[model samples]
Target: MDDTSNQEAYDRIARIAQEVFDMPVVLITFMDGHRQWFKSHLGTDRRENTPDQSFCRVPIATGKTTVVENALGDDRFCGLNDVVDGPGLRFYAGAPLMTHDGFAVGTLCLFDIKQRSFAPEQVRMLEDLAALVMIQVKSDRDIGRVDPLTRLPNRIQFLLSLQDMVRADPGRTCWIVLVDVIDNRNANDVIGALGIDFYNEQVRHAATILKRHLPGNTVYHVGGAYLAFMLDGAQDTPHALIEQLDTDLREPLVTSRGIPSALNPCFGIRSAGLMEMSSPDVLRTVLSAAREARLSERLFATYNSDHDDAQKRMYSLLSDLPEALRSQKQLYLVYQPRIDVASRRCIAAEALLRWNHPIWGPVSPAELFPLVDKTGLIHEVTDWVMRNVLRQIAAWKAAGIDLTVSFNISSKNLFEDDLVSRLSEVLDATGVDPKRLEIEVVEDMNLDNSHIAFSRLSAIRDLGITVAIDDFGSGYSNLAYLLSLPATTLKIDRSLVAQALTDHNAAVTVPTVIKLGHDLGYHMVAEGVELPETFEQLRQWGCDEVQGYLFGRPMEPKAFESWLAASNKALLASA
Candidate 1:
């Protein structure tokens, strides 16, 4: 986001806040990039401060207003900057500048040079002023910010409404029901044949059904195919809502040009008695529970505290990952070599991302993938992996290794318009042959927009980059999808690799796939070949490449170089 526009808007807000508080310091502070930076300020020239000294961070981080009437007497503020040093700020009161998604981006704060206390009315006024700042900031993200098509509150408006809902009087109970609408695969196929307008019509009908299940002026088209309603004074228990919506949605809804079709709308319900809560606190919590119920018959889940903690932790991980990548030690790459079975040579290597969190120790990609996918952090992570992997390949060339490298591309990245251009530029800048870089795309995820994916892959292939379908047999195990793309390699999924050696079905299945790949002009690569028997079986099956722990475990860059040297020396000595 360009902060210039937000900053220009913040100037007016900061002036209003400064006038309202009649204090020496009134500032709009944004807590982002792991530090608090002032967006606009009066009575102080300082632009940014460490998190500890960021008075606004207290409110931003907690999503609660903070007041320190006498800063010097408070242990939390006594020794902090602006307390004992320059400006000598002694009083503080801040209201969290919350975004619609419920994240406290910063705080709208006033600090006096002398000790001061806020009356009840003054405090309420301060909160109202802070809310006004939020409204202006949200308006910057959209013009009036409501959906024209749905004629309902969009995600941003929903967020603003959520803040009000959670902050209402304690006796006014409120519930946030997120109805996630998904079309059945075949039903989607039918819709596709009918056209996009048909799908939109179905969603609109499903939304009406969702609105019927909830009460009073609360329905919102918060996200794609999802309707959200803030319910209060519920005459019925929240669980009852899931029953009726699920029952009504089982049959297909009427579309523009097709017969009525099923638009499965799942429900995730969360309620809070008037108490201070943040947007991420409520929305993400309910989402975690909803995901568990997505494939179930009930298709609805109420928020659980236990479930919420994990979601919170995941949020922290996503927030911290960018900083972790920038640090020296936390995020690094490891290479697992893919070997040619016939030649017994290291033919290629796959660059795997490894995050060694100081507390979590080792976080697996399996756990990391979904966390990032949901949080929309996957694209940046994919970019990091690609740039680093390509750079590593170039470095290897300089060191006389000249290794071919393949790195997994996140499913989310396939949709990026610049995906092809970014890869081409990286490869070109690194001076690495495009063929030496293979992009391992998860084939199943590409099914959603095969034409788009295929188009991007074609553009990528035009740059001489090989496209490999990673985990080919795991999802739906659909082999027909391969015929549509220009894939140079098919990674037989680890699960299939586990059984291919011993299981009769897999033994037949594995060789058949290898031949099919060969006939289709793709190199068949078996992933996760941890045993000699498995390696030998795969070699016998004419697997062109085998990548697994049996060859070499993923190692640090320098360690990989050392291991490669040692292995080549051993081969020469044996010869």
Candidate 2:
């Protein structure tokens, strides 16, 4: 009834009826309980009337053509306002709009001020017109509910069904499950390698498997590679179904094109009372759980509100991060002093990113960077840090403080073709000496693209910037691979530093790594040194720099400057 196409089609039929039967008025209407709603009205200004006063209601009730040759002569409708006072008198003819399931919901009708007889032939033609209207209605409904590819109910239909179920039994519990046949990345890879046809075949194959497993259940094609279905919480065991699917999906899927493909299917399930959540929210919650399963490499994951809430907060941070970078508000940098081991002087600091979210209070870099690494925004984040750090260096230079500041970047940034050039541009713009800036690359980065990473680091070194291998001993540590890089500094990982104080093997290995780095002509820095004894041990082992809470926690620029001044004074007095 809300569809304009339906109204336009009904209007066309109404006009045709008015011209054919030579009636003064024609109407297409639906019996809506208390009133008859006019979908199309011609040759008259009336929009609606009470069901008792409508000629269409009789056809809707009888499921056949209804006619009143003269309402003034008919005892039933003679007292109606249209016959008694409004239109004076009326001749009515209407045909019931019967659905395929044999239910009459509305009618197509004609009216005249003069008494006239509706011939049997004319009544049959009106019924055919009503059938045409039903045809359009059925097509519109199907187009909205059915998925073009899978021929199953679409997401819209799924939501509607869920709503209907909730309305019928608000307190009933149900399990909603989403199956991800393959991740987007692998799906794109397949599309690029073979074609969309092959990819679509895989989706269809997945749908077939789902339907075969859960007979009599409506499966929805919710996404490109996602199929979802709901099960009665009391009747069906979701875990048993999950286990069966896990075993079945482990087998390789061979497409019609004879290409064998491995399917890494993950399931996300949520069981909730119908009244507890809305349909859309249920889908979202299950989707989040499914994503978590894929990320954690699990066969299935049930919805956990804590995990879901954290995921939501993570997404919120990612969305807000770009604006924070642009405004420089909320996002700022703190520097942790890296002390010269022998001289006891602050020679450099590591610039770490911090976010004081207006609502979330403070977001940890530990939580932020992992999420950022998965998106293209990593480049924007890296660029923001680089530009801001350079500007801070220039500001410190203007204040007569010369300190080398280093910042970290993700492994993905190493493959960016323009990374060095962008850094060069920012360096030139800030007018800070390249010698004062350092780039710290993580040690455990995926080395599958080592050539590109090494080349990028080499270019940075050639540009007069220091390159440091960060988190050393935390990842695969190969001496030959380390020697092949152009980096001039190696920062011992905090985990190794912390263990060196307690573990016998770590204590022996820490000094060995420091000696190895020094022998290779690379400056060695020990991280997470929170004790005087750890500092003295590193100093004795010829570690060039030490950075940890023992020296000072990460601080704002002004606080760092004050701490540096006080530290230098203490060093001068001790000397």
Candidate 1 stretches greater than 4 Å from native: 1-178, 181-263, 276-280, 324-329, 357-361, 370-379, 410-421, 445-465, 476-484
Best prediction by TM-score? 2
Q: Over the stretch 214-249, how does candidate 2's per-residue lDDT look in tens digits?
A: 898999998788899998888765888888887787
The weakest ten consecutive residues by lDDT in model 2 span: 1-10
Question: What lDDT would each prediction earn against the true structure?
Answer: 0.78, 0.87
Alpha-carbon lDDT of model 2: 0.87
Per-residue lDDT of candidate 1, residues 202-248 (tens digit) = 66787777666665566777666677777665656666666777788
How does residue 497 of candidate 2 score in lDDT?
Answer: 90
Lowest lDDT block of 10, candidate 1: 272-281
Off by over 4 Å in 2: 1-149, 182-200, 251-253, 259-264, 291-299, 326-328, 414-422, 443-447, 450-463, 476-486, 515-521
